[model samples]
Target chain A: MEQAQADKNNSAIRPVLFCECLEKDGIVRRVAAALLGGYAFTWGFTALGTTCLVALGMGYAEAEVAMLLLAFLIFLIVFLWAFAAVRIDRVWKVLGGGAVLMTVMAWVMQHLLLH
Target chain B: MFNGFRIAMTWVHTWFGLVLGFVLMVCFFFGALSVFDREIDRWAIPETRFEPQPMPSFDRLLLPVLEQQLSPDEQEYAANMPKLHDAGKGPMTPRLELPVDEYWAYTTHRDPVLAAGGGFRVPHPKDPTLENHIHGRVTIDPRSGTVLRDDALKIGSDWFYPLHYKLQWEWKDLGYWIVGLAAFSMLAALVTGVIIHRKIFREFFTFRPWKQTQRSALDLHNMTGVVALPFHFFFSFTGLVIFASFFYFPLSHTLLKPLHDQHAVLEAQRAGLPYERAGVAVPMASVDAMVREAKRRWAARDMAGEVGFLTVTHVGDANSFVSIYRAGSDRVSLVGEGIHFKASTGEVQYEDPPRAAVSEINEFLTGLHLQHFEHWLLRWLYVLGGLLGAVCIATGFVFFVEKRKRQHAKMGGQGSRVVDALAVTTVTGMVIAAVGMLVANRLLPIDLPGKGDWEKWVFWAVWALTMAHAFWRSAPVAQGRLNPAWCEQCWALGVLAIAAVLLNWVTTGDHLIKTVFTDTYWAVAGVDLSLLGCALIAFWVGRKLMRPTTYEKNAVNRALALHE
Candidate 1:
């Protein structure tokens, strides 16, 4: 009976230890992704704002306003994406979408406005 | 009581530096370079004519010809160009005489009106539809509109201006704020470092190179930081102030502007203020006359050298004026008293001689920072001071990593890995980014669709790549030993520099030999050579560092023993 009890205790503790390891790893991954993602997103937002101003013939003041709005919009999108990526375990999808959207938007803005 | 305050300030100084030493080092290194930004730009963009030349009497040589060529309607339009100098009121823009295909560039004097009101100017088509003749540059012989050689001075200024701002962040107000914060942090670090050093005074005269690198680093750090403590503090603090508009104003806006109104107000402000055209039908005075007046004004001020700007204000109005400011003053280049003249009558209206005040203080600080005065001796001293600041920061960075490295090694696993990666990113990564962007500058076509802005993008892109690489590949210990990222970056720099030289030679048909001997040494050529120099330095450093070092072997052995 004692041997059986000991076996049950070990089984229960094993899952707890595994959970702890997962939690720590999850935290680290989340932090790293957020940092890197935030940085990339900031760049994308800035470029988008610049593009909007140039294309729209907006003045410097307007450009600044547009930049702020876009930055806020990007931050919201990123926050949501990160929440899903971290909380819901969709890291790859979030990172992939963020990268594509940022790069595409940046390139498109540059092309359309600059040209 | 003041002495007690002084004692306390000493303590404050010590702690501040220690806390922010590493970042300060970077700031100082970059700041030092920024001091010579114009010079660097001159060095970089070698082909652009940067220096001004005295024009022959335009009225005597080119005016009649231009008057004959210009249509009456075009002449009227040309008269709308802004005037040069003014009295206390404002400065004027120049009227372009386009008949000779030579633009009469006017000099503006120091006029209060120039700061407040419309400049005196006459507008014309900047582009004349003539290839290689569009510059509108003139020679002493007005008939010959020869293009002057690009001066070397402007390139240095161009390169160094951006360097001061730490081109890492997007070219926004925020980037400047970030730099300011970093500088403030450096100030903090400098203070803290002094506190941490128990033997600052004793160590001042002591530098033993044969001793441990750490000791030598510490000594150098203390010596530079301590000896130049006043300079470092003033510079860093003022730098913060200079960028205060970026940080303080924005934060204030955040607090003052309601969330919704901020965007609207900013937008409203972005719409540039309206400008009114001058309608008077009178002929303007000659630019040659203005130049002569400006020189006379400068002479009156006991100043020698050419005027920096000649300003004219209210071209057609009865109050229309011209102003001339002295340039190349040693102590305060920015603050000058100018002589203002009436545009219609060529009569002196008001005189503003230099006066000392808060604005003068500001100018003095800027003068100190810019070395506005052309005293080579003082300039060299400034350079030495700047280099010392760079050394202080570089050593601080090395020290930060070294300290962390010892601790990280004991911790083992990913903790050690992250630190190792950070070290590589901060030190080698920044250098790589700099060199990489430089290469991009030369390689990218000047008239490429987005080429004008590409240099900025290239810099940010390379930095981002390096940081990402550092973060990802750094976790594995063996990866640290390989330093693949570092090696890759070093190799990239070498390739980039080599490629730039080749590209320049191919495109310009002006290699080093032709540049130096045949076509006359160009300013852009200096940049290519500098790029080459950077590459050589990188290769040498990489080779030396990558080679097996006895010191590293011992360090490893020591680590193993400790683990045992």
Candidate 2:
């Protein structure tokens, strides 16, 4: 009874934890990053990223095919980076940066320049 | 050695591998079987392995067969539209489902051989003009004009081929997308795994077989992953590349609509037909004559000069075209050269020259990945690579469970238990289920309606039950001890594989003793011998797993004590 009372008293003084799951590295989030962040995001990213590369290579004759294959290889790097980032927030951030950059470039090339 | 960067990579590698390893194992195992898919098909359908006459004129044999199958009453071909089943032939109307209608779907073999159960694919009706999609198949005695055998069953190719890339799901290319995701995860795992394991080359030669469970499993995992690193990378990359068009075509349509349109324009320019269908009704000419003309042209160019596939469009219209392709066995490249003819006039409409350099390079890569050509040694190499991949994935699964199983059990290890059940199902359970499919094929009444469908149902049903059995038998959780379910299923695999071989011999009357020596169908003989070999291996592994264990009690107590 004395030991139980002492443990209860110890528990009362213990610090509270707000993000216990995140601190421990959330499994569900990690899985989401692997599937959604790594796969789903990389797919569209490759498309846009490669198209941007192709647009940039407009001066070169064989730009489309060469840039296209290179873009395929870049997709692997993007997938690894997504999964390797320490937190879910970081994965989203990296994906967002790529998405935004490609979208801007594609918009400019398709509408402003090509049209 | 395991610093921050390595730690992060390790986590990524482990999680990605765990998430998709089961899926990859299914793909790899089925892919290994598919390497010899035709051989297995020959073994499964014994009646088709007979010696066949030379490739007779298609009109002489097939015309009469089609006439009988589609009697005068049913000759209203253009009245109804064709439906396709993706089996590599034009679809049939409702009346075409008749037993006679089976001959409509016929495929010729690499050789002059043809059979009722194998060695044939579906062709279009008398017009022999259907869009490129494949539907059904039939094998016939080409000389007799009689229906020797006919069905849409692809016991070898269709059953196992789609499993590798599509997992047998036909949900609007959803299977491809799922596998693409798995393939993507695999690439990530491969990259991160190499980064974390800095001594990848050293691990290639390492194997600590005498060590405890955790050590050995990890060692095998590292060894297989590193040794077959090139294969895994190349295959994954090429697999993605092969389907890159599927994803990119849509993207191109969105981003570079003009280029996509220009591509179609160029293709039409080169094709000479422009895909126009004139409504002027006209009788289609003889495909046999077209095949002969294509063969002659190919011979003039010093090619192998045989037809692998024949496609026809606008069957009853004047604008119909007939395309003939060089047999896959003719060359190492997949996109073989072809000549298109006007179906109504039998005039050589256009001949596609050799593939351009870029297309040639792509075809070479795809050919290396697909291995439809007649090179036996390289095919075996592919099989070995596939098995190594299967081993790599299996060991990864084992290491995941073995490393943390004890600790996990302490926390009421629901996660680890679920993984264990899944592991057993995908690994050993898959083997037994595959064997059960063959056994069901042999035992089921051949004349039964929908025999092919029953074979597929049995395979899937057994697969599900084994998963259920693994969970049902192991759920009570006896701590650190190995699940006896593993041993039970291993025994089942061994028994079933061997029994499948025996059943083949008993039912077909062409046992190994005769097939190995007398018959030239090494494909049939090879499948039987391979099954026997698998049975021996399964039995050996079963014995090893059933051995006495010294770690059970400590494992149980420590895990149980975690909650207390």
Candidate 3:
């Protein structure tokens, strides 16, 4: 009976993911995607969001602060989504590609405002 | 990812929580101590044990101190003068000859001394708009206007407080980035923790200490984590929020520098405050009278308060302005309601209006985390919340080890052993270091040169020793048995805590009896009592660890059989 119970516990504790996702390299990539990619996305979001809000006539300080207040929450969401998402490539594309797009938009907007 | 959302979150919660839990332990522990940092300062520096004082007379007392021929901090002058001064434009100004550009004095309700400083301007600056100033600071006895030794380490404020936020690792702001990452991970862990915890409500009241080690540790972890969930979440959230602009993102300084500069000029214009000094040097004003007018105006607005911060911008120039800010001891916000005046004529330049909604929310969040308020009950509650955070992280470490040690032992793996060692180092070893520093402070001669540096060395050395001892004894952990280091270190912590109290009495001659009953200095008395209470708890835990249950014995026998 004890042996049978131990076997049941072992089966219950089996890895949920296939072998590749459980590999060391796979874990590292996922973590990097979560932390670094999430950071890039959040930075771009803060820059663009602050610029857009300022362009919309909010006070500069207020707009910057409002965007900063939301930046971490957004980062937290994407960080978790990186791990939970179905495809690692999709996670990277969304975070990395979105980061670039928003950053360019913010730079262009800033250039217009300055000119 | 092959798992559902819950399992993925569980993986995140377990792994990220484990990795960052060590840093979070330091943050929570030191942060709890920082709630009564001023009180601890009083205990550490016995000479400054007098009652807290209000702001002293600025015109009569502070003016002479500020105007007296003062030299800029040597380190600051050496490090910054070359960068700030364009030597090609002119020779670098002598440290003593640097003209004063700003004067400021700050005091809190809990401060027995007033801290005053002056910013000395660099003549030929590389970037004129930048803060091109070297600073000199002094701590003044409010009652006597005497300067105290600047070398005395404010162990509470200087050491423990910074240790929480930056781990005292200031090399290229590595500590801040590491802490930021840990704080961000903390938020993720908290969210993932909630998703993973299936019986949060049931676990809030459940603490089965008599269960197996894994079960018991999880119970405590769940209980502490759930009970202080709001505190854990808000503190981590607000801590990040507090540094979000300066350290985390810094968008205004980087991406939005142009807009930020524009806003600054517009802000200065709208507020009628000068952003630059006029070349004309003239200082003929009574600052005391201006302070009185500021106080009267505050009273008129139905918020009577004492001055918490006073600053003179563009010092000794026509554009100079004196700004007085009321100490927010009565509320949860930081110092506010600043009133500015023309320094030459004492005419009111501007009075700060109420904050906007966003700024107000920001202030409240930062204020709650920084805790400048004077409510004793709320301070104690915050301490309780901080300790709960520490407990949650510590138990998380224990749960990690307890659940895996046996399996790792069966596999002849050393992962559990290494983690158990580090767990012992951070938990018990960290406390030993802090208490050991207090003991060293009491034991060192009061007049010894660089005594504070010696005390700090003792802290690091003791912590290193404890780590070594923990790792050496962590061998037993590979057998799925208790690390005897945990019990030994608990006793060491207990003994050290008691020694600190006794040494304080011997060195300072302020025994608990005298401090509590006769002298009535609750600051020192409270610290002494807390040390004794800590000793009692540590001894209790030591005693508990000395006794092994059936589970440990079974694991030990299994390990012996495997060796055969």
Give the top-scoring candidate (lDDT): 3
How do the candidates score on chain B by TM-score?
Answer: 0.66, 0.84, 0.97
In every candidate, what fraction of the native interface contacts is reproduced? 0.00, 0.17, 0.66
Candidate 3 lDDT over B376-429, as tens digits, reads: 889889999999999999998898888778777888979889989999999999
lDDT of 3: 0.88
Tens-place lDDT digits, model 2, residues B108-162: 3433235322111133444444432223334555556555334435577778878
**Models sorted by TM-score, best on top:** 3, 2, 1
Better of 2 and 3 by DockQ: 3
By lDDT, the better pick of 1 and 3 is 3
Which pairs, if any, clash in model 3?
none
What would the DockQ be for model 2? 0.17
CA shift of B509, model 1, Å: 5.1
Give lDDT for model 2: 0.67
Report residue A53 deviation for candidate 2 (angstroms): 8.8
The residue-level lDDT of candidate 1 at B92 comes to 31
